[model samples]
Target: MKTWKIIVLAAIVVVIDQITKFIVVSTMQIQQQIVVIPNFFSLFFIRNTGAAFSLFEGAQWFFYLTTVIALCLFVYFIKEIGDLNIWTGIGLGMAVGGMFGNFIDRLLFGSVVDFFKFVFGGYNFAIFNVADIGLTVGIGLVVIGLIVSEMKKKKTVAE
Candidate 1:
């Protein structure tokens, strides 16, 4: 993947994430619920001051530090790789974009705006946002890429 393409992909994720958040914030009140599918999913407005599932609530400085470190590591990893495959590039782009999306929220509002909610088997799942989706999918893609790369290397060695 080219550097420009990676940047463009990341920018697109950030833009979509921000736009969705803006729409939610502008139209919904805190704790508001808009059901899109009964007994399955809904948009539930809430601000999370911590990590996933609201863990370590209110540790803003810690989050800021960790985010910076992670981003730096990402840059280093990409550079070390020299050339990224499509999956790796797209994965990194989405991951970075998602991180920045939440980081921006933390900087501007002291919390991340989460609204997407899911329920399964009568248990409520963690409420998350677009950024979370990007991060999760991105990481999954990266993992798949790594596995495929390793498999290819092993096959070559055997041959």
Candidate 2:
């Protein structure tokens, strides 16, 4: 995939993520819950001051530093590995978009606005947002792409 296309994809993700967050923040109060699926899912508003699952709570500087480093690494990788495969490009783009989405929230509000909630069999999952979804799915795709690429290389070498 071309670099420009990847960038455009990333921009799309960012737009979608930010729009959803804006809507949630505008409509709901902190700690508010609007159940959508009874015992399964709901829109629950909360500001997370930490990383995933609320780890390292209130460590703003840590996140800022790490996000900057990660963004630099992403740029470096994209430049070093030009003309990426479709899966890898799309994955990287989504990950970048997601990272920036949360970064924007942190910069503006000092925390991430989270709303989506899930409960399965009495196990309450971590509350997350669209940015988290992009990050998770993008990383998963990247992993899968790498695995498939590696498998192809091994097959060619064995032939």
Candidate 3:
């Protein structure tokens, strides 16, 4: 849970996320789909100019501003996150990494590159990328950390 270690973890995530995006952009054409599993999963290239799940379709400026605000919040939270557990640290790192990963795309390309796709029960799931994975999982970890912290506080008060 050291700050440096947390930063390193975030850096790694950003690197991996960017590399995967680079590969996808370089190798795949827009709207291309390569089935990894029939009717289940696939690599489908897409560009999203909106938020997660491609909502709010053309809000470029909105995303740029939000990324800046989120990064600012992350820095403030990190300063307050003393003595947190590894999971919390991982969450912080991943969240920041994911933010940066998507922010990079938004800055350079005006959109995010999405590649992974899933289909379930005749529903075509939204296409996403590594950054989205990191963001979702990271947010989940943060929530878990918060729950654990609350439980500990309640236990102490009860005891």
Candidate 4:
């Protein structure tokens, strides 16, 4: 994919993530839940001061350092994106955009805003935000791309 296209896609992710977070922050109090579907899903405002799944809570510096490292890796890998497939490009764009979205929140507020919630069978999945969604989906795509590539490589080698 073209660099411009990647930029546009990533920008869209960031814009959407930020906009949703802004709405949550502006309209909802902390821990405020707005049920969209009874007993299933809701929007709840909260802040995460740790990594994904709320790991290492209150360790802001750790997250800051890791985010910087992740950003650096993204920058380093961006040059190689020219040879990647469309799905890989999409994954990379989403990952970078989501990373930056949360990075900005961490830098500015020392926490990441989360609002989406899913509860099933008495188990509450982690409450997350748009950035988290993009990041998770993006990483999944990247992993799938890697797996597919490996399978193709093995098939070629067998042939």
* Strongest candidate by TM-score: 1
What stretches of model 1 exceed 4 Å from their correct place? none
lDDT of 3 by residue, 66-153 (tens): 8899889877887886767767778888988888899899889989999999999799988888888888898899888888888889
| TM-score of each candidate structure, all chains considered together | 0.96, 0.96, 0.95, 0.91
Compute the lDDT of residue 67 as modeled in candidate 4: 75
Q: lDDT of candidate 1 vs native? A: 0.90
> Taking the candidates one at a time, how many backbone clashes does each contain?
0, 0, 0, 0
lDDT of 4 by residue, 1-159 (tens): 566666777788889999999999999999999999999999999999987679999998887888789878866776764566666677777887888888889988999999999999799999998888878888787777677778888999999
After superposing candidate 2, which stretches have Cα over 4 Å from the reference? none
Task: Report how far off residue 120 is in candidate 2 (Å).
Answer: 0.5
lDDT of 3 at 62: 89
Instruction: State the C-alpha lDDT per candidate.
Output: 0.90, 0.91, 0.87, 0.84
Q: Model 3 misses residue 31 by how many Å?
A: 0.8
Residue 84 of model 2, lDDT score = 77
Compare candidates 1 and 4 on TM-score and give the better one: 1
Candidate 4 CA-lDDT value: 0.84
Better of 2 and 3 by TM-score: 2
Lowest summed lDDT over 10 consecutive residues: which window, candidate 4? 80-89
lDDT of 1 by residue, 1-159 (tens): 766776788788889999999999999999999999999999999999998889989999998999899889888888888677888888988988898899999999999999999999799999999899888888888888778778889999999
Model 2 per-residue lDDT at 39: 97
